[model samples]
Target chain A: MKILIVGGGKVIYFLCRTFVSKGYIVTVINRDHDECVRLSRRLKVTVVHGDGSDPQILEEAGAFTANAILAITPNDEDNLVICQLADLQFHIPRTLALVNDPDNEEVFRQLGIKTALSTTYILSSLIEQRASFDEITNLIPVGEGKVNVMELLLNENSPVVGQTLRDIAMPENSLVAVILRDDETIVPRGATVLQSADRLIVMTLPENYSQVLKKLTGESE
Target chain B: MSSDLRYFVIIVGCGRLGSYIANKLSHSGHSVVVIDSRESAFNALSSEYSGFRLEGDATEFDVLKQAKTDQADVLIATTHEDNVNVMVAQVAKKLFHVPRVMARVFDLKREKVYHHLGIETVSPTLIAGDVFLESITTSPIAKREGIGL
Candidate 1:
């Protein structure tokens, strides 16, 4: 498998090593000339120094032939552009992006990215998994960071959509404080019905965060 | 245009071109809102301009919502970075359902991608090329004058 990665950092360094060790051809595109030089010198992977969002640059990096394109730029917009060009123009089979802002993960998905990794979202989920045994691992810090506030979208395909709040099994430590729908904020109640495309402002305790997120957005799992 | 025909225009970015567009739109009696990440960029707006100024990243959903992009009749993205403009235009058009969305793309090739995505784009590179060609092809005496047209 051929993998093309845009942006270089600790993530790309490890990813390059792992993928190369697995015998997959890896190509990296980084804007920093010096970083590109160092990456090419240290790693067996190919490195191209230019704006990865540019079609000419991507073409030079062999974006068209890649099995997967991972856009790991720090800026959400940059990452989105890289993924879009890879998916739409080059028709890369899979497009993955690393979203620095958790808020952009869904937006990137909606824009047709095959995969999005949000550390904030991942850490919470990881903590939720470990704490599942304890029934609320967030009590002792689920992962590394503490996330109390989050905004989640209810996709049209969500099973929980249209279900009354009272009927849903919400995690014990979380509260759905605000529901944003069509420019209006609704203070939800037990009798309130969840709707598709609704943005929920959830306040969750670290321990029970995973369960709350899972119940609210089961489609992602 | 009639006085009652004022448009609710949302503009992201306050760079050279962004400020120019915002200034012209505001003076033309449109309800304009300009957003920029840096507060200092807002200082570029002319004194006669009377538009709402928002200090935040325009590509962010929360910032767009705060600017009331959903209610905008039109959105013009003039960020210095073409990728940022394209991202903002896509969000305003697809997510918020803005009736008309346009972006200023520096690279002419990138403009084609945005056009395929159904975004209206203006490429300054192409425009500047024509401007230079026109200026250079004109007679020597015309060079003494301020502009060609």
Candidate 2:
């Protein structure tokens, strides 16, 4: 895909590199002349040194021909305008804008921008997950509710202590993904019995979350 | 706009930032409702607030109706997913015509794009920077304008 990224910051740099590595045609537009010169040299992609929101600059950067335009500039207004120009004016098939303010996400979506990334929302989600669990150490969403992989620390009160995988009444759609104990990870089988300090990595559906929590920690929900 | 002497606010996402905003608004005596796709997110909230909680995708029309977005004075989206947040906010503002809409943003640079699209955004990074600056400096009136705090 021919992707036009409207930014020259570190985010754009990484994005451009990723697209280039994937063998996609990448072009970046930025106001900083030096950054453009450096990026154009570092990555074998087209770089335009001009204001991204300006129609003339966008035209020069071939905004109309690109498969998608990503407005990732640090300034929200610029990203919005660039997306508007790409989506509304140029009729680009895909337009994505980075939303710096979680609050303005609605405005961009209302304007018909298909994709928006808010860092605050991402960081806060991570922080909230960390705050919610005591024994469940790391909870990462593998794919929606189909698979949620979580790292669990087994304290003395855990019900799985001294119980082999075969004896425990594990819920449906739940499986032991991995086990980390004493700074080492092991793939568990039916013969594997959990120790008191064993850190188990488990995957389960969203519906069986509380049950899994209860089973692993022996805590009443 | 009603003379019923009650202000209604609807917050979409029900995540940490969303819950924080809802709690703050509710504490200030405003009628607030919070909605999220996941029910687990709303478990920590107190039940004393006169607001409803609905579990569904915020971008869906049916979900918004269930949450009574039409009657809200303001709709805020703080969902970590930017696409969902923006979609919910737009639906609330343009479709439901909520009087006010606010979105939380993580990337400090997306401010220009959001502004151009006619959305109000609150950036925690910028707010924290301003607060940090304010602590060492004397600017009482400047502090008052930092988003009703």
Candidate 3:
């Protein structure tokens, strides 16, 4: 994908790296000359030194031809304007914006902008995870609750240890998506056996949350 | 305009500044709508804002339609990404014909270009710098803008 990113901060830097690693054509626009120099020298991406919110600058950076535009600047207004330009003017197929304030998400939505509110999402995830540790570490709803993404931690005394996924009676709506052991991640299969100290990422229904948690952690209480 | 009349405002990208604007606008009797792709971002909003909430990608045309962007009088894009904000604003102005479009700009060099394109830009870093400079000055000329510390 041809991607245009407007920002030179850590977020843009990391995103550029990820996109490049995935073999996407990435171009970054920023006002900071030093940052632009650093990215150009270090990363396999294009760097443009200009204001990303400006039409002239964006044009200079080839915003009109980009397949996807990511507005990850520090200011919410800039991100919104960029999305507008990409969608309304250039008719870019995909435009993603980073929302700094979770409250204003509705405003962006109403204006036909796709936003990712990181602060609000991260804080909510942390709070929810802390509040419902025993049930599930992370319960992220996907596709309007048709599927849920959950993170489950396994303990040494869990009853499901040493048993394969097929041996355990998994919830009807639940399926293990990924497993984190030490630092590596593994895709769980029916033949995959449960082990102690494993962190499982599962997809299930809201109603099956408790059941899935119980089956994975071996703690009914 | 009657003080009792409610104004509808759409703010894209619910980040720090976006949330601040939403709180201020809603408190001032404006009906606010927020849209973000990240479902978890809605927690920052207080229950006082009873406006519609949609969790989806802002870049997708369907998501914008779901947010009712066509009916909004003013659209504010405060996302960190400049490209996204510009794209959203451009669409609102050219296609949807939103009366007012305000964008937050982090890059100072693009300010002139944004103005030329008929989009309002706000930079926190420049504003903060002006505020800092105004505080140290003895003449108090900077106080005229009310940007003092």
Candidate 4:
């Protein structure tokens, strides 16, 4: 896969390195001459030194042949323009923009930019969720946040601790995908018995996450 | 002039061009709001200009919403930066559905992109380039034969 990344900074270096190591062709467009020199020296990728938002610069960086475009400029407006140019002019299949303002995520989507991710929104939501739920050891958002994969650590206080999998009424669209007990990694089934201190890997639709949590911990949020 | 004929205009970026247009529109009895990132930029407006001066970054969505861009009859983005002008003009046209959206883009090449996106653009660079080319190529017509000859 060929990827075109616009803008520079530490993030560009790391992204370029990771993508290059994965065997994907990567091209970077940055405005700073020094940053471009540094990136070219350290990474095996094409580096174009110019304003990434400019159409000429994007063309010079081979945006036409790129399969995906990532606009990660510090300025949200520049990022939006770069992504829009890639989507509208180059017809790139995938365009992702880093939205600096959490509020602009919806605006970007409304403006037709695909996959506008706000680091601030994700970080704050993760902190809030972690602070509120102690049993949920890990929560990963999948399918653009419509679904979530969560690891729930069960204890004696859990309501389903003594119930068999058949007896526990998991919420609609939710299931226990896996259960880890001491040294055993078991794929859960209807006949499997739930036990305290078991780590359950649960997959649930986002709407049913709270219900699933309540069923396991017996505590309503 | 009837009040119904008046326009509600939103001008982003209080630079020379933006302030000039804001002053003219305000003088013509149209309701206008000028937005600028720097508070001092509003000083460019003349005392005769009777309109609102908002100090904020126009690229930020909240600032445009605060300016009530949805109700604007016309939105003009005259920011010095070409990218800023294009971004702001697009937001007004696409998001707010402003009736008329115009932007000043310095890059002559970018004017085509802006027109393709359905936004009107004025390129000072292209205009000046044409004028300069014409000045050198077109010989001054001797309407009254050389007087000093």
Q: Tell me, by DockQ, which candidate is best.
A: 4
Name the regions of candidate 4 deviating beyond 4 angstroms: A141-146, A177-187, A192-208, B1-4, B139-149
Per-residue CA lDDT of candidate 2, range A1-221, in tens? Answer: 88889886787888888999999998889888899889988988999888777667777888778899989877565676678778766778999888777655655666667776666655665566556567777776543224667888999878789999989989888988888889878998898889988888888886787688888888855
lDDT of 2 by residue, B16-65 (tens): 78888777777667888888878899975766555677888775566778
Deviation in Å, model 1, residue B128 alpha carbon: 1.6
Q: Interface RMSD of the predictions, in order shown?
A: 1.1, 9.1, 8.7, 1.5
Give the per-residue Cα lDDT of candidate 2 at A69. 92
lDDT of candidate model 2 versus the reference: 0.77
**Residue range B20-136, candidate 3, lDDT tens digits:** 778778877888888777878777776776666678766555667777888888889888876667667766776678888887777675565466578787788899999888878
Using all chains and alpha carbons, the TM-scores for the candidates as numbered come to 0.73, 0.47, 0.54, 0.88
Q: Which stretches of candidate 2 lie over 4 Å from their true place?
A: A132-221, B1-149
Question: What docking grade does candidate 3 earn?
Answer: incorrect
Predicted candidate 1 versus true structure: per-residue lDDT over A1-221, tens digit per residue: 99999987888999999999999999999999999999999999999999999999999999878999989888889999898888888999999888877777777777777687787777766565444332222322222235566667788767789999899888786888888899898999999999998888887775666678678877322
Question: Tens digits of per-residue lDDT for model 4 on B1-149?
Answer: 57569999999999899999999999989999999999999999999999999999887889999999999999999999888888888889989999899989887755555667787889898899999999868977557776795
Q: Which stretches of candidate 3 lie above 4 Å from their native place?
A: A130-141, A144-147, A162-172, A178-199, A206-211, A219-221, B1-149
**Pairs of colliding residues, candidate 4:** none
Worst 10 residues of 4 chain A by lDDT: A123-132
| Span of 10 residues, lowest total lDDT, candidate 4 chain B | B107-116
Q: After superposition, how far is residue A205 of candidate 4 from its true place, in Å?
A: 4.8
Compose the digit string of candidate 4's lDDT tens values, residues A1-221. 99999878788899999999999999999888998899999889999999887789889889889999999998888888888888888889999999888878878888788799888877776666667778888877766567888898998998899888999988899999999999999998898999999999999987888888899989887
Model 3, chain A: how large is the TM-score?
0.75
Residue-level lDDT of model 3, residues A102-140, one tens digit each, is 644555766677655556655675565447466356667
Tell me the tens digit of each residue's lDDT in model 1 across B18-71.
899899989989999999999999999999999999999987789999999999
